[model samples]
Target: MDAGAAVLTALCGAESFSAAMATRPWARSPHFFVHYVPVENHQTVLTSPAHTALSTKLSTELPTDSSLESLGVQKLGMVVPKRHARRAVTRVLLRRQIRAAMAQHRCELLPGIWVVRLRAPVDRQAFVSASSESLRIAVKAEVATLLGDVLRRCRSTRHAAQAHAQPAFQQPSTVLSAP
Candidate 1:
């Protein structure tokens, strides 16, 4: 893999994802756990459950850059008990689907991390009967919707901040020197 990909893999690795989530901001879905961490130059997205028990302290650091282009998405899945090998395979498939969705909607994102976690009780039958294609489509649609919402909010807030930061201009007064 290339450097960017390698770096991503290392940063968002299963163990690291769990560790980061312990201290970062996160969102959730019925079958997912999501964590986000904004960093300089790039954002880190971590998805994990196996290392959920791990903990980390939150940092107050802000990213150096503030654009939507430096964002990334990490998709993670958990291996369900009893399914053994099938559990592993199913989770990999799920990750691939989520990645595809992220690729399609990446442009709408801002400079931040996005993590997705899929949770559930599982059995051998669940993996064997799962429809990966359908899952991919659903995830992509949701991702697109989320990106739009986030971008909209960011723009509005940015405008408000700029308005508040600038001082209002005063008109110059002209004095007449009539004798």
Candidate 2:
């Protein structure tokens, strides 16, 4: 397997999809919601021959000056429910928009499986034509906004978790004997 695929396998296991789906949604917008699950360790899984081969292949494919260890692999799935989009073309357009938004934020995305699901239908009355340029633009804009919001929320939550994880120092109690 190629280095990219190997990295992906290491970061996202066989059941990553189900795990991602089960995770509490990280963020939500009017039309889209995002679910993410972080990868804790990649080295522990590289003991298998298949994983070793994949890692070697990835290392060779990586740039001579670059380090693959820093690379964060993530799996992504996009969903456009039929209920949300009646037309197949509309669903395809929405998926394309989601992919575009993901690509734009590829570098900034954390190492995790992410699923972008459409929860609501676009306003058909606003754009009468399913394949209109205006519809495409609107979908793309909404997807971008959704992804941005999700990322922001993820960062905030991570910070909150870290804050909570830190030990809080307590002041020693002072007792006055019947004073």
lDDT of 2 by residue, 1-179 (tens): 23344232222343444456667778888888888766553232222344455354665453321113543666567777898888888888887787767766665566656778788887789878887899998778777777778778767876887789987888999988995
Q: How far off is model 1, as Cα RMSD?
A: 9.2
TM-scores for all predictions: 0.46, 0.61
The CA lDDT of each predicted structure is: 0.46, 0.66
- Evaluated with TM-score, which candidate comes out highest? 2
lDDT, candidate 1, equals 0.46
* Tens digits of lDDT, candidate 1, 1-179: 12243112223355445544555334444444545444432333322333233435233434333222333432222322333324555556556655665555444433344555555443445334454555556545654554455456556755786789987887889999999
Q: Quick one: best lDDT, which candidate?
A: 2
Candidate 1: misplaced stretches above 4 Å? 1-16, 40-86, 122-128, 131-179
